[model samples]
Target: MSEKEAETPGKRTRPGPRKVTPKYLENAALFYLQRFATSAANLRRVLMRKVERSARFHGTDPAEGAQWVDALIARFVASQLLDDALYAESRAQSLRRRGASGRTIALSLRQKGVEGEIIDTAMAAADEAEEKPELAAAARLARKRRLGPWRAAEGRREARERDLAALARAGFSYDVALAVIDAEGPADLEGEGSL
Candidate 1:
């Protein structure tokens, strides 16, 4: 029988008389964390997966096997190997840079297990960093989608209203939607009192 297989079941894994080295487990966790930053919750879940597999191999109860994994998490957290706040902040910033709106980014963070107050704060910070795209990008998307070009010649008011409605449906806030849609709209329909 293998050395590990010869161990008695009555002994606790931690500080036990056997050669219990968590070096491999520690290396596995550090390697995973090195390649990518992870939320504390996510790291714990990963450790939990390893614990379950170890339990299956030893015929031990999952809870008994998980003590080591829990210890791993405690070590990692104490060493600052996992930080949920930093993870949430970085993720929100990345999504914002990719053009996600503040509201959308907040929802994404919440789904990632980020707390509501932290998510709200992160999104607020992202908004401060975001420079509204001068409506150019929104206009370009409208042009590509062909949702615009207010037909003022066909009667101004109806065309302006339609353009406004289309931009609203495209996820832009009222101010941004109006600015971009009107930027490409017929001047007569958008600004002048004309038929």
Candidate 2:
């Protein structure tokens, strides 16, 4: 390309590169943790993604960048700043309160890099405490979305299929979805069922 074409009249150039030193990575890690709770692997993935972007724009070696990422992750883990088990437990509780089914909570935690065993343990704890974890979550979802028992009587009949589909997409089992959809009122869905 000619110099004239390269120097476009109104195009914006990419920003200058930031150095990816250990101190820089540490500061980045601190900032990330302050803003969000994360699993060890999730934190590593976030830091490595930044490193990859930095390497790509600055023309640095990827292997070196990866090493830096690993070192920072190890430091964080050693300091107890990155704990997957804690993250999974906290995340599971939050999801449950927000009307997420056990299946949905597990999937969400797994996607965030939590181990399956940790997810299972956290959910098991929830189940032990709640009469029916899935039922409770489905009830909360119905109330929040104004589906089933929470819906206006005039609209309930028409919205049945759509409400069931919504529950299904949210990871509720067939029986759970049906229970939520068929509830006469929010109180009706408070207990466990044969399904």
Candidate 3:
């Protein structure tokens, strides 16, 4: 197209790049950010979706969508709206309170994208604050399942093996389960039991 045609109103043949409106982006970011503390990755995904959807509806470019996510995250960090370390700690503590083992808590946090070191550190902190429950906790769990503290002089070796196996499957250490089994005797609802 000639310069004269380009300058003429409605004569241009090409569409220029569109500018992403700052106000629209700001509103989109605030909309989701208000829901709760969110991770950078999750925020990005949500923003990307919203941008794409809006762009389609309004004849806007999808690339403009990325700007809002970065803007939102920077604001969140500056305002202390998002902190992975704090998130990890809170999640770790919550899991522990529900009777989850240290290993379980660590793995769950890791699955949520927490770094291994952070998970380990949080778990260590939790351990100090909440010492491991005595073998009794494990025993109580075993007993609840009717696995038992095996009788000292009661059933066949096979019955004893079954009790030992059950305890091990419950995630209790061999030592904890055995000690409890020895003290309480294996369950034998039908009189056939183990020590």
lDDT by residue for model 3 (1-195), tens: 677886887864655333446576666667766875545555666667767766766777676557656776678767877666777777766655544455566666766566787777777766555334424345545545555543334553547677767767655677766776665344422132111
lDDT tens readout by residue for model 2, 134-181: 888888888888889999999999999999999999999989899889
What's the TM-score of every candidate structure? 0.56, 0.89, 0.51
lDDT against the true structure, each candidate: 0.61, 0.84, 0.60
- For all candidates, the clash counts are 0, 0, 10
TM for candidate 3 is: 0.51
Ranking by lDDT: 2, 1, 3
Candidate 3: residue 195 Cα off by (Å): 26
In terms of TM-score, which candidate is stronger, 1 or 2? 2
Enumerate residue pairs that collide in model 3: 149-181, 149-184, 149-185, 149-186, 150-181, 150-185, 150-186, 151-185, 151-186, 155-193
Q: Which runs in model 1 stand beyond 4 Å of their true positions?
A: 1-21, 131-195
Clashing residue pairs in candidate 1 (N, C-alpha, C atoms within 3 angstroms): none
CA RMSD of all predictions: 11.7, 3.2, 12.8
Candidate with better TM-score, 1 vs 3: 1
Question: 1-195, model 1: which lDDT tens digit per residue?
Answer: 446746876655553222223665677788988897776667767766666666556555666546766788788878877776778888876765554445566677776667887787776665564245324334544555554553433554556777667666555688866765555454423232111
- Ranking by TM-score, best first? 2, 1, 3
